[model samples]
Target: MDGTVDITMPAELEGTRAVVRSWLKSVGETVRRDEPLVELETDKVTTEVPAPADGVLLEILLERDAEAEPGALLGRLGARAAEPAAPTAEPEVCSRQSAAPAPPALEQVREHRLSPAVRRAVGQHGVDISVIRGTGRDGRITRADVDALVAARASAPASGSRIVPHDRMRRLIADNMLASVTTAPHVTAVFEADFSAIIAHRAKHKAAYERDGVSLTYTAYIVAACVAAMRAVPVINSRWHADHLEIFEDVNIGIGTALGDKGLVVPIVHRAQELSLQAIAARLHDLTARARSGQLKAADMKDGSFTISNHGVSGSLVATPIIIQQPQSAILGVGKLEKRVVVREVGGVDTIQIRPMAFVSLTIDHRVVDGHQTNAWLTAFVQALESFGD
Candidate 1:
């Protein structure tokens, strides 16, 4: 006796919604247990759902581009050599399965990966897409992929003009950015932070941290500073609701990791308030490596309460209004770390000094917090960095 295994959408989707991006295995195709059976795309990330058991794909409940709620049935896998009964689930999808539903058309499945942005660009520009090669994920076309072609056609193109587009990811990121700026009243407050103490601490412990397999990153210190700031202004670690404010006790910090020209992903270091400096560094190292290699899971990008954008790594001195991630009240932006001339009081005497410093800014949703709270948070954050013990 053999029973069908249910394959369903993941219950803990970041946004509680997903679209069936593609069916990796067709109905009637034999698959191994744990094999990737389908792909689902949420606004946060795209993830592959695996087969529940070794069996033949007996039915597809959700076709490509169909919306799915958490735990909605995606398909059914029947035990090999046993024909399962017509699944009582979503019978409407049965039409896709006739007596012998044909596998998805090769071109249709591939073309579906092109985002509406790409489609619109193709129509708007009237460029022959066939001649241009795709540089996006899996070699799919992207708006950036299309733009480079148009730029090449121009009479004179500037240096470093091409941008890499990773199709769906880029499109979703753009939409979220547009919505955030439109919905939230953004206000940014800038401050200068002295990292002299942190630099000294790292220099002393870097070798020891390396021995323990941790990189002892500056980000670890930044995260610790953020937690300290959260204590000073708890509202910084909160979300805005129409009726009230929802402040969280846990400081889940999302570190914005850039992937060269492919944009960035924010992987949260959950409950940062409880993590030690070494532990924070370790997690950042792992999450960042995985992010760049395309190995991060959907869960890695979920449930962020606050975010930190270390934009300084790319050489920018500062970026104002680094758009706040929606729902979250604020985002901390760290600019390029460079030594500069400054005035310091030493033994009650003020004198000129050269110190390593970085410009930091807190971009907040004015509806959620006021300047007093924003400035208070930045002051606390800088104090944490400057007051690091020798």
Candidate 2:
């Protein structure tokens, strides 16, 4: 007995209007249950749609580069055969000279081993499969490996001015950034933060954290502080609807990660208000590592109420009016940390001191967050950083 299964676009991809990047299987090809059958590329991420059951691919409703929406039928799968069928007729013999040439061993391997997406990429790039190395399981060539090769080839074009084509991710990022800047009346408030306490605490606890396989960084402290600040000024962690402002009870902090020319991705730390400093550090480390390796899931990039852009990692001193992540009312930017001389009154005597400091800026949607509220959040964030031990 045989049954047919409809392969539809996932519900999570409702709004992305993803395009069929590549099909990993062809009609008549055997497919295993849960095996990926196609690759979908959205503005935000690239994901695979897997088979519903062990079966043979019967049809492809949408071919490569076709646009798809949520619940759109992509293909059909035919139920597995119960048993091998006996030969119905004898084969006719042919002379060796009249026979068709056999496909190369590499081509044969690729047909069976590579996904439709990877195969399409390999063909489009005209890559010499014989020389390319595979990093996937059992030495299978993956889409990422092919993309990396394509990128490398395009890296040094003619040594002159060139027009670089933006990938889907880059184009989507640009569209979102433009939409954000245009939609929100961005207001920026800059504050000087004293990180001496945080620096001291991390220096003392860094070794212990390393022993536990986590690199305790300043961003962890900032995320903790952001949580505290959001508690104090909940409006900072809110979304702006046309009719009203929606404040969330839990803080979902989106940490902005740069992917070189590929643009940025913000993997959220859900319910951040409940996490301890160490837990936040561990989660951030995992998310960051996964993000860079293209292992982040769709859920990792959703429902972020607020965002933190730690531009300091790349030595940015200060960036004003950093566009707020859409719907979210505000985004915090941390600038480069540096030692600066400051005046302080010690026991009624004026004293000059050198302190580690960073400039923190909050870019808020003026419609939702007022100047007073912005100041309150920044004050709490700075206080948390400065009073680390306490």
CA lDDT of each prediction against the hidden true structure:
0.84, 0.85
* lDDT for 126 (candidate 2): 92
Clash pairs for candidate 2: 23-116, 24-116
Q: Give me candidate 1's TM-score against the actual structure.
A: 0.78
In candidate 2, stretches whose alpha carbon ends up further than 4 angstroms from where it belongs are 11-17, 81-113, 116-125, 128-159
lDDT of 2 by residue, 1-390 (tens): 167999999877776658887677889888898997887877656777889889999999998768997789999999776668888898998887897977778667766787766777778989877666653434567665677678767885786765454666777778889999999999999999998899889999999999999989889999999998988888888888879878999899999999776678899999999999999999999999987777777778889999999998899999987888898999999999998998889999999999998999999999987899999999998998899993
Clashing pairs in 1: none
Per-model TM-score versus the true fold: 0.78, 0.83
Query: What is the C-alpha local distance difference test score of candidate 1?
Result: 0.84
